[model samples]
Every structure is written in structure tokens, then in C-alpha cells.
Target: MGIAGESVAVVGAGIGGLSLAYQLKKQGKPVTVFEAAAEAGGKIKTLHLDGFELDLGPVSCAETATLKQLLADLHLEQEVIAAKSAVSKRYIFSGGTIHAIEPSPLKLLMHPMLSWSGRLGLLRDVFIKPEAEQTHSDETVAQFVRRHFGEEAHQKLFNPVLNGIYAGDSEALSISSTLAMVKTLAGTYGSVIKGLRAEKGKLNMSRKIIGIKGGFIRVVEALQEELGADLHLATAVKKITPSENGVKLSLHTNEGEQERFFDKVYLALPSYACADLLADIDAQMASALKQIRYPKVWQIYCEAETSDQVFDGFGFLVPAMERKSLLGAICITNLFPDKAPAGKTLFALFCGGDRPYAFEPSVEQAVKEFHSILKPSLLKVLHVQEWSEAIPQFYVGHKKLLQSLKAWEARYPAIFFAGNYVSGVSLGDCVEYGLKINSEKGSVEVR
Candidate 1:
């Protein structure tokens, strides 16, 4: 499967695109990546202000083997660094208070996040036979959760945390696709607690849940350097056309319209962007791609250091039932001590996802709203130093929409789709999927 004279064009220089490029280039394929933005890394952008490290998108990567293999292949194992404090634990906001998410099953049973009734509800999952339809249905997460767990679990437990990830309402997100891991756990062990205990032996402990030593974008920079001149920044792909020989692309650059042909094309763009390009190539696929939904969120980063303040732990997630305008608050300082200067903490705030009623105001509005959430507890002077232009959204119906997109790929052998919008939203998952797409043939299917 040497690409030799065959050239592969990657549409976006995000993790997915870079991973594909790296894998293909390794396999003797002539690979070229086109980035619409002035720089690569896509949503994984990092900004430094007043000596504070701000991650506009992802804060950390999960401890997984897929990431280890990917990074090891790129020789970035040494670059990985864990959080400074062992208190790098997630906090869940429930009943107007925050509680650390206990890691162990015994602690989880004692955890205050779930009420006695909720705990009982969790036990029911062990005896409850998984619905036959649920095993393979393409339904929203809300449906599966409400059916299996109950409304309280759906509202209090899954919604907020998932909203933080997808930034879309779980009610509309595909259950089988978005939460495949959970489904696997349920189907296999019939209980999350049992699953963790049984599968712990198969896990690799070396890959810790952390970010890069410098910043997440450092990984992107390293990938760019590895790819060398093969990476093209500030090149926007306008459209992709399927030809009898291969695939033709129309691109927009400062120099003007450019046409390029490739033996294969990997679209690492957003679902909507993919729809736009596929419209001329495959109308049915474009229709299904257009159905994919994405919500919008506004991320605001504030740099505030106070020797007097005592906010501990990684971050806090807000449940929709709380009626708070903020989705959650991450004490970036606790996650990475060096993220901010000494005595100062970096507070990252997220807002606007799933709930339309949630206010999405200016930096002033978001900062002011968050002040109310933190002020009562910390009672400190907080000031926002920076803000992002916009946040991404992974909407409902994304799974079925992907099915249609892949079907189009089946029809067009040389065309493929890979991105956060397609299979996953995590940096690790995106990278893995990109490499998988390159290695596999026929149709692009995620299962």
C-alpha cells in the first residue's frame, strides 16, 4: 500500500489531518495538508497572555493507549507532563454545591453527588437487562439515559458533563454513537463499577490524563515540524469534486483560486463545511451532512491570582437543573500549577450549550455572571484578562448524519471524511480516527 506517485490531500491541519498526514507520509505516501487558518491545531489553539497559559479548547487528554501509540509514533512521549497536583480531580456541581468526583467505586458509593435514591437507581442497572433496541439503535442520548437510568440521572449526571464535551443537548445527540463506551460498559459488565474493576488490568497506566509540558499547541507545533514543508497554512479548501480518475479540489489562497488533484482526499473540516463541498459532488450526502447539528459556546479566560483564595481541584461542572448561566468553571491553576504566575490562578469559564435560555452575553456579561457563582464562595476580586472569539458545538443527529456522509464515501472510493465532527471530539480520538481512515479501505465506518 505504498502511495508512491499518489498524492493525498488533507483538508484541515487539525489533529485529524496531521495524524493522517503523519501516517500516510510514514507509509511512503506523498501527503500535503491544507490549513484554512493562518496556523494549524484548529480548535486546540492555545494563547498566552500576561504570562498565563490559556487553552481555548481542550484542557487535557484522557489517559488512553490510543494517545500513547500515536504520540510514541511521533516521538512525543518525553514531551508529556502530568498536572502538578494530585488533586487533579473533577468536581460535579449538585444541590448548589461542588463535590469532588470520587474515582473508586467504594468512594463513589459514599460520594455526596448522588442522593440515596440515585445510588439505588445506579444499582438497578446491574439487574436491569439492556433494552434489545438500545444495543444498536441510533437514538439520542437523552432517550437511552431516560430509559435506562431515569430522568434525574439524565438531567443531573449525564447532561452537564456531556454538554461540556459536545456543547450540545444530549436529548438530540445519538446515544449509540456519542456514548459508545458507556454502552459497551453497560452491555459487557452491566454495571459501570463492575466494568472498571474488571477492565483495570487491561489498562496502561503510563499514559496519564494531562497536557503537554509547554502547552497543548506544542504537540501541534511538533507535528508541523515533523511534517515539514508538506504542511500548507492559510490555504482554504473551497470545494472537492470527485472525478473518474481521482478527486479534484478548488482552494482559496492569497494568490487566488488554485486547483489540485489527488489520488485521495481527506476532509478534516467541520460537518457544515463538509456539507458545502459535498453538495456539488453528492446531493444526498450533502442533505444528510446538513442535518448534523452543532451548538455554539463562548469561552472566557480570566487571570486572577490571590494568595487569600482557596479554590481547589481541577474544575466544576454545572448541571442544567442548577439554572446557572455558566456551564462550568475550571480552576486552571489547580490543573496545571505553572499555567499562571505564582500566587495567581487562571479561571476558564464556559457558557451556551443545549439550553437556549442560557445567556450568551459579551465577555463582561459572562464574567459578571460567573462572578456571582464564585464570589459567594471565594469572596475575591476576579478579573477576566482574555476571551475567545467563539467556541465550537457538537450538535444532535451527528451520528446518523455521519452514516450518510460515510455512505457517500462508499460511492466515491477516493473520498473520505475525518475530523472531530465525524467520529469524536477528543484530540486523541481525532488523531486515532484520522490514522484509521488512512489505513482502511472501502467505506469510512466508525464502529
Candidate 2:
């Protein structure tokens, strides 16, 4: 294998872009990272407001193998602060109440979240063989779950859980894109339950959620220190031009506009951002990039400090069937005690997903709904934040967009797209994709 470039330029300072820049630098490659924002860490922001430490973005990492290796490589293992065991636990709203989700699927047989018929239907997964055509087909998650686990499970169990991750409706999201592992099990072992039983070791069911010591900002700070001057903060990449020498970046900084050359350029920005950059380069590529969508969400952080107002465990998710304006709530204090004061408990309440019928959630609406879910005597609303362009949606036919991207990259070769739009929408997924980059080849496939 041979390196594609002597110098690499990474656009956007999000987790994905920074990870790529870090990997390229580690390989002894000259790397430059450009971020339009004054600070790095795109979605991994920690808000310190009114004596409360709230994580409006991702609160924990999945502790994947690559993340463990990353911490070791960075020699920042001390930042590996373990969360309370209860942080792994989650609850599902069912029958007008919240029920704790069992750690194992077998336990679902007795879980209150499912009706008698629905509970019994889960057993049938061991025997029912999915349609052969669906093994590799693009299908809606709602159809996939109903096909295997029955309608009740699809509504009560699958909807909220998947919503927590994708912030979109399961009926609209592509099953292969969202629940790929479980879907593959049905195609491979003839039954999802059987596949799970046979592949327990590979699944790593024992892995615990890893919360960073001081939200995710600590990791970004470490990366910033590692990159030093190679990282350009408050610098906007205006235009890109490809030539035989390399790609020239028209960078706009406080110092003024200037052109710089790089052997290659990797885009790790949002889909819309990417589309804007490549609109003139290739109309087909720009069209494909625009096809990807980012849904909006409102994350409201509040706390209840009174003894009678305390809420524990991970948090509860309201199934869409509940028809509530609230989506879910996270017990921030339970997960990271130091993030909240000793007497105070913080919770990140969320609403405003892709449900068209629902009204845009106001702070008042969220507060009332939060009261319905978790009643607290002394409810204090700390802050209300909205990400108009939140998590990327992987709707059905998403794979087609990915294929088109590959085709475009094949034609261009000098530029590649990365980040949450192409990554798996997880702290670990983005980091892993960047870490796996073949700096030797100076290219990494998003798929």
C-alpha cells in the first residue's frame, strides 16, 4: 500500500474530522484540520449553566473496542470515568406507565411492557423464518419488527428504543440502516433469537456505557492539544480546487483570505454543508448529498433538587404511540454524579422529532410533559436548546445515496466525505471510522 498524499486536509472539527486528522498525524503524515467554529467538538458540547453541568449532546460513549484503543493511544486513560451501573438501564413507556427494559430478550416474556399475546409472540421468533427475499432488502424498521416480533413489540419496545437513537420514526427509517445487526441475524440464522443465542460472545453484551470525566469536551480538548497549530480554529474553508499538484483550499481567517495546497481533502461536515461545497464540482454528487436529511430536536435541561423530586436510573422513553410531545428524559446526575451538585439531580428532557402532526415544542410544552413523566416538587428549568439540524436520518433507500457517493468519489479521488451523515451516528462509530482510515492509502470508505 502507498499513501495517496504527502499532506492531508480535514474539513470540519467534529468528532469524525478530528479523529481522521489525528489518525493521519499519528501515521507521520502532515495533517491540517479546519473548523469554522471558534471551538471544536461539534455535537459533543458540555453546558455549564447556573451551577449545573449539562451535556446537551452525547452524554456517554458505547465503550467500543476502538474507543478503548483510542484512549490508550492518547494516554488519556484517566479520562475513562466509569458511570454508575444503573446508567445502562433504560425504561419503556407502556400502559400509561414506564417499565424498566430487561437486560435480556428472554426476560421480555414477563416484562409488563408487552401484552400476553405480544409476550408470547417473542418466543415465535425462535421458529419463524423470515422471507428469503428480505434477507438483504431495504425495508422500513416498523415492517421488519412487526414481521418478526409482532405489532405490540414493534410499538411498545422497538419504537421508543430506536427513536432514542435515530430521532425519527421507525416506520420511515430504513431497517437495514438502523437495525442492521438484528436484521442480518434473521437472514443468517433463520431466526433473530437463535442468532442472538449463538452469537452472544461476539455481541459483547457485557460492555458498559462509558461516560467521559467531564462530558465529551475533555476528549476534544486533548485532541486540540495534540494537533497544536495543525488545527485551524475560527477558519472557514471557502472554496476547493483540484489540480495535479494537489487540492487548493481558499481559507478565510481573521488574518485574511489565503490559498493553501494539500495532497488530499476529506469532508467531515454535515450533508448540507458538503452539498454546498461540491455543488459546482459535480451536480450528481451534490444532488446525492442533498438527499441526506438532518432532523430537528429540542433538548431541555432541568433539575429537581428536593428529596421527593429525585429520579434515578438511566431515564424513560415514551413510545410514539403515547402521542406525547416529550420523547425521553435522561438522568444526568445518576449517570455522572459530579456533573450535578450533591443535592441536585439533572435531567436532559427532549422533544421535537420528525413527527409532522406534532406542534413545534415550546419550553412550556416540554416542561408540562416532563412533569407528567417525572413529577418533581421543585422543578427548575435551567436551559432550552434546539438543534434545527440535529441527527442525520437514514430513511429507506439510504444505501442508494451511499452508492452514489462511492461512485462520485471514484470519479474525483481527491476528496472524500465523512462525519455523522456518513458515520453510524454514535460517538464510537464516528471515532472508529476515522481510526480505521488507511492513512497509507489516504482514503476511508464510509459504508
Candidate 3:
């Protein structure tokens, strides 16, 4: 398919938008990307302070095949760096203590994190049959885990782990939206454990977590270099109007307000922002987009005064049931030695999720609360950052919202949606979805 006269406008310069622009450009399509921020790589911010390299957003990326191919295509394979094996030694906080998450199955069976009964409950998953209704219906992650593994497993094992990833309440998050692959496994095999056992050899369980040597910002820089004049910075799209053959975008630039028309427009923004852009085009579509919710998150980067190491492993997640002020914490220096100078320990503390501490706090208040909860010996705060609407929470009815989005795209063929909110949240998910765009058809099919 050839797109000779057709032109595309991508809003937002996040990974999704940049990757989509790159893919569309490769297909010989005329493309332009508009970014409100001066720099690209939204939510993938990197900083250098106190002689330590810090990543405030995503710390690492899973070495998925799609990501690997993307790096290869960009000739960035040599820049890739793998985290230390010690990063795999994760931990969980429970009962006022941190317990190491053992990787060995035998050691995990006797792991102190769970009681003996809870350990046995995991083994019973192999024999437990998936509920017929649950296989077809959308349910909370807490409900699915409790039914299959038992309450102890749900509380002790899954809750904190899920919180570390989603920063969401297990009782409210939809399994079908967050862990759709796992849900499919259970629904297909009638047992999640059985499904895992059957696909043991086929699964890529040993994939390494990786990052660029310098920072993820290099990715956007590379894309921008290729885009050249096609990339606009510090330009915001104020309004969008649909036309018979294309769309009209009103932009707010440094000079003045301007209007431009495009054959197609791809919104790679947050659901709420997309809602605002499409409000005039279709009230129903805008209403559906408004239904999506995004949670606020505070990520604090701190350097410990003591040279002595903290608990080894990736980090520990605090279960909401524990009623702790912290959502989780990651030992950045422990994961990648190059992140900080030798004899210096750096940690990234995360708070504010679906729990009571969801509101943003002053730097002093956040430091005080963090000290009270973590009790790190003589902690020195390096950076305190907050993302007001950071991660999108895939609530109980997220799947229904996705279906509605699909219908909206069918009705409005020239306006397409692509973002972490529409697909999975991982960088790999966004990149893969971007690569799958059919520029000739002016449509994006997000599976």
C-alpha cells in the first residue's frame, strides 16, 4: 500500500507517538509529530544529580523480541546494557520485615514470606479447575487469585507484587485488562498452574531487563534526528475538528495560534487529554474517553548517607493491606552498579497510589513520611518528583471502554487512538503497537 498524497499528524512525542511516526515515515508516508514539551520521551525522564544517574520514570525495559528488533532497526543494539543478575533477587515487605523472594522453586516453597499453608495452596493450583463463569467474565485480580490459589496467596503473594507493577487496588483492577495473557492461560487450560507447566519450555522466562547506556532520552533524540523539521516542540494542539475527508487541528505555538489540516490524526496522548481533543468531534466519544481514570504517583530518588548496603534484591513492595505509607521502593544502585558511584547507595522510593496517600505532598512532608515508613539510616533526599496523572488504572470496566474505542474508530476512520492507555503500559507494548499501524488505511489496530 502506498500513501503518496496522504499526510499524518501525531500528537504527543511520547514513546508511542515517536515510534508511530518512525514507523509511518519508514513506510514512505508523510508524517509530522507535535510535542508540547521541549524534549521528548514523556514519562521516561532521566536525570543526573549528586554524581548519580537516576531514572524517574521507567527504570528498565523487558528484553522482548519486538524491543530487540526495534533497537536493531535503529542500530542501537550496541548501546543496550543489561542489569546485574543481583537485580533478580526481589523482596517483599510483610509483618514489619523484608523477606527475600527466592527464585528457586524449592527455596520458594519454604520462603518466609508465606505460611506453610499458603505455600501448599500454590501447589494446589495445578489441581484446581478454573471457574466456568470466571473464564468468560471480567473479574478483579483479587477475586481471580483468591478463587484459584486461596486468600493467603492473594494477600501474601499476589497483592504486593501486583501493587508494585500496577500501583492499583487488586480488588478494583480488572484481570482481563491488566493480566489478560494470564487470564487467557487460565481460561484455556482450566488452571493457571497447569497452563504454566504445559508451556514451560515455550515460555521465555529468562528474559533480561535492559536499558540504554546513557539514558532512554537517547531514543527520542535518535527519532527526532530522523524526523528533522517534521518534529515540532513546545507546540500544543488546542482543538480538533473532524471533516469529511480529514481533520483540522488548532495548535497553540510560541508565536501564535495556528490551524492545520491533515488527512489523518493519531492521538498518542493520555485518555483524558484525548477526550478533550475529541470533545467537539463527537460528544459520545469524548464521554467514553473521560471514563478512563489515571492515578497520581510520587517517585522520590534518595541517596543513603551510610555506605553500608541495604537489603539485597530489586526492591520490596508494600501491600495495601499492610496500611503502610509507602507503595514500594527500588534499590537503583543494587540493580545497576553504574547508576551511582562506588561506595554510594541510591534508592528510588514510590508512594501515592489507589490508597489513602494518593494526594501529592510537599517535598518535606514526603521525606518525613518516607523516613517514618522506610526508616533508612540517615537518608538524604536527592530528588522528589510527582506525576499527577501518571499510570492509567485499568479499572473493572476497562475492557468495555476499549470496545467502545474500537467502535469509535470504526465510525471516525480518520481519527485513530494509540497510547499506553489503549494497549498495555510497557514500553515494548507501545512500540509494538506503533509498528503495527497500517498507514495506508489510516487506521491502527491495537490487539
Candidates in order: C-alpha RMSD to true structure: 3.4, 2.2, 2.5
lDDT for each candidate structure: 0.70, 0.80, 0.80
Kindly report which residue pairs in candidate 2 clash with one another: none
Give stretches of model 1 more than 4 Å off. Answer: 69-75, 85-88, 103-116, 130-136, 189-200, 203-207, 305-309, 356-365, 376-397, 437-445
For TM-score, the strongest prediction is: 2
TM-scores for candidates 1 onward, in order? 0.87, 0.94, 0.92
Please report the candidate that would top lDDT against the real structure: 2
TM-score leaderboard ranking = 2, 3, 1
lDDT of 1 by residue, 176-214 (tens): 667776667667766655665778888443355787766
True lDDT of residue 62, candidate 1 = 76
Candidate 3 off by > 4 Å: 103-109, 120-124, 130-136, 305-310, 356-376
TM-score of 3: 0.92
Per-structure clash totals for the candidates:
2, 0, 0
Residue-wise lDDT of candidate 3 within 1-447, one digit each (tens)?
136768889999998899889988988889999998888888888888768888878888888887888788888899888887767888777887777776454676787777888888776556656666354588888888887777777886777877788777788888888887778888877778677778889877778898786778777778778889999999999898888888899999999999999988899998999999988777887887887777778889988653344556777887877766577788777777788888788888887777533444344565665565457678888887888888888888888888878888888877888889986788888898778876556665545
